[model samples]
Target: MSDSKAARARPIIVFDFDGVIADSHDVCAAACRWAAAELGHSDMPEKPFAELEAVTYEALAATISVDPERFAGLVCGALEARTTCAPIFFGVADIMMELSRDFDIAILSASDSDLINDFLITHGIWHLVKCVMGRDVPGSKTEKLLALKSAHDGKFVAMIGDGVSDVAAALHADVRAVGVAWGWQSARRLRASGADAIAMVPADLLDLIVVQELTEAPTR
Candidate 1:
């Protein structure tokens, strides 16, 4: 392949849905509370999103005394709440549209696929995304990343998210992981999880992707 063609195909940016692109913290928390109450475990501490962000899904289920098997149902309920009124972060749609011009943009989220699709459609950015792999997509994030890497061949892959699981999945797949502080997890937690860099805002994330693409460009 020519250098230009290779460069055009080099970058594949995978984004996490909730917290990263969509501001659904309150919705998620409400869903969690509702799920806990429904499961007869409303006594769990009402922790802040930052603290809760550090906990794995299974751990969260255990923390709330909900059976792991029932966690998906809880998440589905959360999605229903989210779909009713989840707002995309400021500048997210614009940046995603800009980036999609030069990169393969995709979503690797724990959010339901239908919900993700609905959000994209609602925001009119559905066509900008090349793929959408939700939690029910038949594998873990690590497995999904691996599959994406394999499919993309020599493309340079980066995982951008607001959770520790995102960073861990990127590391496991041997790709770059960029954590956004404005998301669900704290910046401190993201850094500790081995994020290649932490983006404090949407513009910062855009700049990071631009810089990475340029740095990876082939020279004559």
Candidate 2:
């Protein structure tokens, strides 16, 4: 066996706030729905999430307009409202505490930082994390990961999210990626997107990140 500290330092877990930690699929879709209604689209195509995921807010907005900034403020309002309307997945707080005992937890999501902070405060679990990063940071989520890698002195980083953008960030930073079913993207789509692993429940996430369960995890 190794030093307890050494075992805890394998990978820094960067979790995306929206889909993975909370039911933000609908929170974000509410924004898109508002955007669609504004443009008079018959319906929001991303509602089903049916395997094809719209990753970035900026990218998804283009489907409705050439000038997305014009609608940014409006959609932000709806997303802010919807994020609080739903319940977060079960065991999120409990598992987050367990995960924090070993891994350094950071929040990196496409969500607006203000909203993420609000949700965290509302949930009373915000203080458990090491850092909170959002898309608004310089160069966005991908850039934030690069910065995190640089800061960690080249430790293996694990990016946890429920969207393709999260996967892209993990790949760009040369980190492992885990997608959770608790989020918006369907389980099938997450696998197709090349996630290293996908957890069916918040408790299942414990198997992958912590060394305590390494020998106990089911072999493929």
User: How many clashes does each candidate structure show, in the order listed?
Assistant: 0, 0
Clash pairs for candidate 1:
none
Q: Which 10 consecutive positions of candidate 1 have the poorest summed lDDT?
A: 211-220
Q: Tens digits of per-residue lDDT for model 1 on 74-114? A: 75766666437589999888889988877888899877788
Residue-wise lDDT of candidate 2 within 1-220, one digit each (tens)?
2456454454467888877787666656766777767767645675534444556656666755635665566667677665344456778889898877766778987667878777888888888777887655657666788777656555644788887767766776667778887676777777887788888888888877774343121222
lDDT of each: 0.77, 0.70
Tell me the spans in candidate 1 whose CA falls farther than 4 Å from its real position: 1-10, 44-49, 52-56, 81-83, 214-220
In angstroms, give how far residue 137 of model 2 lies from its true place.
1.4
Task: Tell me how candidate 1 scores on lDDT.
Answer: 0.77
